[model samples]
Target: MDAYWSPLCTACEGLESGSVLVTPVSERPFEIEATRDDRIVVKFRDSGEERPLHREQFSVLVDRLEGSPITLETLAPGVEPYAAVLSLGPEFVSDGEALSLALDEAVGGESPHLLTPEEARTRPERVHDDAVLLADLLDRVDADDPSSLDTGTLTDLYVLLSDVQRGADRVRGTARNSLLERLGPDQQLHGRFGTVRRTTRERRYSKDDEIIFDALDEHDVPREWVLGVDPEKLDVVLAVTDLDEDDVYDVDEQVYVQKTGVDEGEKFSRLQGLAERLEEVEGGEAIQEDLLEIERRIDEALASG
Candidate 1:
């Protein structure tokens, strides 16, 4: 059976304001604007636009969206400027009579997004959702006051801790990339609260069976440690081979819920290193000022750093 649209008509008919559907992982919100005969008006909430999706058009949109993936950090709901730009907050840009919204997809590298009118009025509402996540995590830890030996259940603690690390890494990775784009990758960026440095690390890996097997043979290493075949190649083999699949490989299928999004582990490590290198610079935060004054303050900050 069809997935998102299987209940579309029924859902729309049931609701007073048409049908609303959000994605499972990202909470990427989409809704039906209104019912029109055979078509349903659909759009992601943050998209600031709507689409007339034929019931069969779900796959096409999903393909486009997944093709142009945005970072998880940018998708925090109910935040200030983001919320306003998403049309979830108070208002949006207007061309006198009608409201206008940003139609561009918020995906890809750190490129300049056009300033929205909502930004100016809604700047003060900025707060990273990660703070709330971390706060909750800290609260849980404090409630139990568990130590390494005396914890009630290590499973929940381990899972939550890992999630917190990943969430922090996701935010830090986004911030690092943003700063790296503006500042040189080899340079340090001075912020109001902290300084961030960028450094390069080299990671090497190979997939060629010839080279891999030759190195293993030369080192007298057991080749079976790696199942004697790369998983990717094994996958291809499984698709076409005539042999019993179970004889070649054992498959175990287990289901579990997980937080879904991109997390660059290497970038996170680099960010963590940067955090370690941070020094406490004694000064007050620069007060809010006009554009020129802000520019001067930035220049002063850089000079001081």
Candidate 2:
């Protein structure tokens, strides 16, 4: 198969330039190119015979790939004028030549099942189960048979998979939080704070996190202690810790720290741990002054309070 740039449209007038891909379907290869108006032009690869199809002079290709991975249907003449490949997986096969070439190059090197033009359009409900449909699409790709799909379907599949992954992450997070609440009161699991923005220039702490840090400063909590706390939610993350020796307590509601720093360290050890933990947080490096500056600021905040 070969493809190149071509502006030849002798059979049609006033057509725009487009790309062309040549491939063989059965006996001969054909040149298929797109026009500026989004129409297709076909020509024999060897004989240079051109056939410009009218908009409705082609066939509709209904891709029922879920069940028959290697099969496609061709609409009967007069039913649809144009030929189109729709579904997910690969680029459209322009003509019979390309289709045949795809079959030849298919995974098993076997011909694809070309259904009758009358059987072209298959009902979606009639497709095999979801698993089978997905498997078929994957299998066809593995076999190097991409002519079964169009660009739109491929994008749709990509979006669907992305959504599924995000949904799964949310579910896992919920389950993990439930398990952590049962891990006892004295546990200090190391974790990081959330982010307000992802961009480097715009990244900052959430408003609630800002307020929590401010409250910690007002209560004279050490900077090291304030930076190392993590909570499942903002509302419950500000409670006093044993590290805060000011004897502070909430009479009605206690702060819930899902994770906190360890107490088995000297002042320097605690400062180092907090610095390391901060680096683990997203936007940690840019969150505050430099580490040396932060150390100095910590002492200043402590002395001033």
Candidate 3:
């Protein structure tokens, strides 16, 4: 039976010259030869120790040359003696375009070389869906009057909103890092939070709270109502009075503020809501079906093992 060989095949690595490499096309093993010429001649190794393969039994290995730094001179010669050079056809050229074409064929095509837009789209579906939903929920909160929302509703919203924001941060961080690694540092940065800071009264309150208080007081009543912040695009500012001190804060009554822009906060909130909905949906029968299928596959694999 003819053997198959692929450079990328794990079995092909570290193969010595003159070693028999199988071609999947012909299912016959050919003796490898390293040549000083531009081409390496693949032939049947007829050592008395092993059965001598007939001429019809072996197929020639032809590689088109390109401008690749690799040349036949660099190939290590195998154990086979020089045989009459068999002319297959016109000489293969190593021009840039031809070389590229050869490489493309050797690797089985350029399709795997680059991702289609559809594949790229699938890559971000989970993250993008979460972002959109969070952005929508945030917009709803921004439009509503904080005073109109009751404490229970506010707490629930805050909890949901916070969860979404954190989730978004996690996804964005992972996706951004992945892109950066693949595309290099020159590409645009991908995450919502450009910078993050831990909120501390001591750090933000300045030497004189009176001076900072006065500055804030100059703003309108609604603006003055803002208390606490966590920085960046999320810029979470809350109507300090709306929070139930006992429920929202710890025993110390210390609540960390997220400083994010109003627009960004709105966007984040919508995305958060969407993510929550997706999780809820995923908890249903559809996801269970997927789990069942996975279980079935695992069971089948175990049985085979």
Best by TM-score: 1
lDDT of 2 by residue, 1-305 (tens): 01111221222233222222222222233334434343455665457777665432222232332223322234343222232212111222334322322233223212122222222212321121221223323434432533556765564344333333344345445645765665555544443422122112466765677788888889999768746434344334334333442333445767842322312223224334555766898877664334434333432332233
Query: Model 1 over residues 188-217: C-alpha lDDT tens digits?
Result: 777675676767789998779788888899
How should the candidates be ordered by TM-score, best one leading? 1, 3, 2
Candidate 3 residue 124 C-alpha distance from true site, Å: 8.2
Evaluate model 3: give its TM-score. 0.21
lDDT of 3 by residue, 1-305 (tens): 02212222222223333234332222234443433223344454333233332333213333222233223223324311111121111122222112122333333322111222222232234344433443444445642676777775565456545544555466556754665556633444433424222222454445465666777777634434655544332223324345354554445556785634234445444544554665788465654455445434432332233
Clash pairs of candidate 1?
Answer: none
Tell me which residue pairs clash in candidate 2. 24-97, 25-97, 25-100, 56-81, 57-81, 58-81, 58-82, 239-255
The CA-based lDDT of model 2 is what? 0.36
The parts of candidate 2 lying over 4 Å away from their true place are 1-24, 33-38, 53-59, 63-305
For lDDT, candidate 1 versus 2, the one ahead is 1
lDDT (CA) per prediction: 0.43, 0.36, 0.37
**Model 3 lDDT, full chain set:** 0.37
Q: State how far residue 300 of model 3 sits from its true place (Å).
A: 44
